[model samples]
Target: MQQNLNYVYPQVFWVDGCTSASASSPSAPPVTPFPPPVPDRRTKPGHNRERRSVGFLVIFMLILLALTGVGLSMFQIFHLEKELAELREVRSAWPEQSMEKEARKAAHLTGNPTQRDLPLEWEPISGHAFTDGIQYHEQGLVVNETGLYFVYSNVLFRGSICSSQMLTHIVYKKNPTLPGSHVLMEDKGINYCTGQKTWARKSYLGALFKLRKMDSLHVNVSKIALVNFEESKTFFGLFKL
Candidate 1:
């Protein structure tokens, strides 16, 4: 039985057979293997990097939007202040030939007080007239009443350039009913003229259509507060006005 153990190679080609059988067949077709699976093309490392960059750009844009809002608010506030000043200047000059009348009024108002019917309290001066306390100063004359207030000035005959030049303290209000001369600013708005020359200043208030008075009793003011701290609300002069 072992006499024919050797295998004879086949002359015809064989298909889909074991390796050993295929080896014995000289005409066996070569086997083809599937290529390694193609790597996932859509989820590459570079693609993930681009997605992260886009997310960061979106966050940066949101931060820039918030900063822009704050800058706009500051700009608006500054413009409003400038416009208000110009309006006051126009309003002050509403009287006839301003310079001549104011000079005459200032001369007569020295050492005199202007009298008003309004109760001694803080109130608007645009349309209202104060008949009470009228005092003169180097800067101008002032009409004061009871209670703390920040009254608006129309225009000064002599406006100061420096803050110190305009600095002044406000004396508290005095009762007209009291017997003694209402203290001419004994407590506040005092400026020493020891080193400098005392400048004479004046103020006048009246309308073009109305007749103005020239009664003298208003004290000439030396304190320059009406011009100083002009930009501040100035409701109180260290007395919580």
Candidate 2:
């Protein structure tokens, strides 16, 4: 029993075999090592505000651009409307102006033929008579306006000896396209008097015609000697419709 023996350490007493100090301390609450400090993932308040501000700015810019576009479009439309209104006003006034101009073109002329059986010549009835629409040349009335017109003429025939010969009166027109003058109206009379005596007759012509510019009108009679040269008895006139 007294033999000398070497003390051998128990395997359970070794630090590697025993529980760790962290597990042994019961009074200190469990030293649970917190997982390596987790990095904060939440965005900062300032960063969030900056992102919101950026989004707001972008939206505001988009809205501003839209408003500007709308305003420009409205302005353009208003301008176009104003121009259209002005054009309409001009169009409305055109007809009245044209009518006034046409009214000023009325002409009343008196026959002034120097020979018989020839085309009747004419002179302005009054100093204020308008003859701009008509041209008097070679015993003809040349039309300068292409429109419907009321044309009138009167002629007085008188003779000391009534031979009862046929009297022919005609209104002739010469068109720019036609080669010759064509009779527009004609009147004939025979046996107007029974015996050899003074005889007098009056012929009048009035009609509406669609005349073209450059057309010419003239009067003709079978006998030039029978015509009375009185201005009041022989006249020609025209007025636009």
Candidate 3:
């Protein structure tokens, strides 16, 4: 074959058999020249198709990223709205809860002896005796709310003649849940007096208990006749914890 001396510039050939060159002669084949010669991508149909596929893939990835970002933003907005709704609910209920707590704090009463029944009755309003949320019923103090409470009682005993019998003072709760009163606290006096002479004794009992609404508390002694019905010496009282 005859040599085609039309080739003027240095020819560049890639591994794929594509060529690249630049010529000063106008008759030279049109070729774009660049350093570090690579495949002549413009001349090959398969190369052109590959470049188009890569461009489309890049565009698809960009669209997918944008959609993902929008979805995340929407999710964050929904979460914030839910938290705000919960905070509003709590804020709306706060005042009522505070009022109830104040009411519970005021549920306290003290009573002095008024009657000599088996379950001693009391005068809740006379002398130092006072009643708030608690009420004095038939023969006991009635609970108006359910909570822990401090129950307390004091009793004084005096007689002209000393007796060998035991002295007992008890504070108990009467509830519908049980058939009988449940003793919450008790005190017993033994050998309190030695001679057959006039003497006086005092018994006090106090404790913490879990009380329920509608429950009643009463004081009991072994002998009602021996009790001194003084307001300062004999009284029952309770306050919420």
Candidate 4:
């Protein structure tokens, strides 16, 4: 066959009549089988949908765990608070606590605190002689049971906070200070407790009854004389012996 002059191609022809393409432009090599899919699932096609770096994934999971832990802790706290409220309600329903609160209030209102031992304002009587003795007096003697006996001595009878005020207070004893008393002398002027005496009233005899029984001064006065209050009067100190 004649050569086709219109196609001056570079293909080599074999002298034996076989035609061959040039090695430089040989047919493409057959494609090797696609590489086996990577063993790691991370590189799969679906992974590209919302890809995350390995470090970022780890960080996100850690953050979720922290949030879950915080939520759980808050739930526990609220649950404990609820339980505590329930317990308080149950306690308030009990009767003994109400009684206890009332008892505490009563004790505080009426009870004297035992913490301190203060001196009592009371004093004891000398004896029944002071309690059941009759009233008597002597002249020029203080008759410490002195009463409004002397008008001039009334100035000395004035009671004052200052001891220098010459104020005199006479304390007396009576056998029976009751109304309708018969205060007889133990032996006339020999009955002078401290001697000097002025006029004294039988009513003042009740002072002895109080001192011996309650150990307290029922008649608190700053003057020495036959002073009267209501039906009571200051008395002469009784002298028995």
lDDT (CA) per prediction: 0.35, 0.77, 0.81, 0.32
Error of 1 at 208 (Å): 24
- On residues 1-241, what C-alpha lDDT tens digit does candidate 4 reach at each position? 9876794445554543444556654553432344545676456775664465666898999999999999999999999999999999999887787764443210000111121221101111222112222111211111223222211111112111222222223332232344332322111111212333342312112112212221111122333231232111222222211
Model 2 score (lDDT)? 0.77
Clashing pairs in 2: 116-224
Model 1 over residues 32-147: C-alpha lDDT tens digits? 64456788768788889999999888888877776777677778778888889898888787675465344332111111113232211222132222223344322233433233
Better of 1 and 2 by TM-score: 2
Root mean square deviation (Cα) for candidate 4 = 19.2
Counting clashing residue pairs in each candidate, in order, gives 17, 1, 0, 12
TM-score for candidate 2, please give it: 0.56
The best candidate in terms of lDDT: 3
Task: List the lowest-lDDT window of 10 residues for candidate 2.
Answer: 10-19
TM-score of each: 0.25, 0.56, 0.56, 0.20
Per residue, candidate 2 scores C-alpha lDDT tens digits across 1-241 of 6976885432222243333234334444432333456889999999999999999999999999999999999999999999999999999999999978865546677766565447766676454334666777667777887888787878898998869579888888898787998877788888787775788889888889888888888888888888887778888777777
Which residue pairs show collisions in model 3? none
State residue 79's C-alpha deviation in candidate 1, in Å: 2.6
Cα deviation of 65, candidate 4, in Å:
0.5
Candidate numbers sorted by lDDT from highest down:
3, 2, 1, 4
What lDDT score goes with residue 80 in model 3? 100
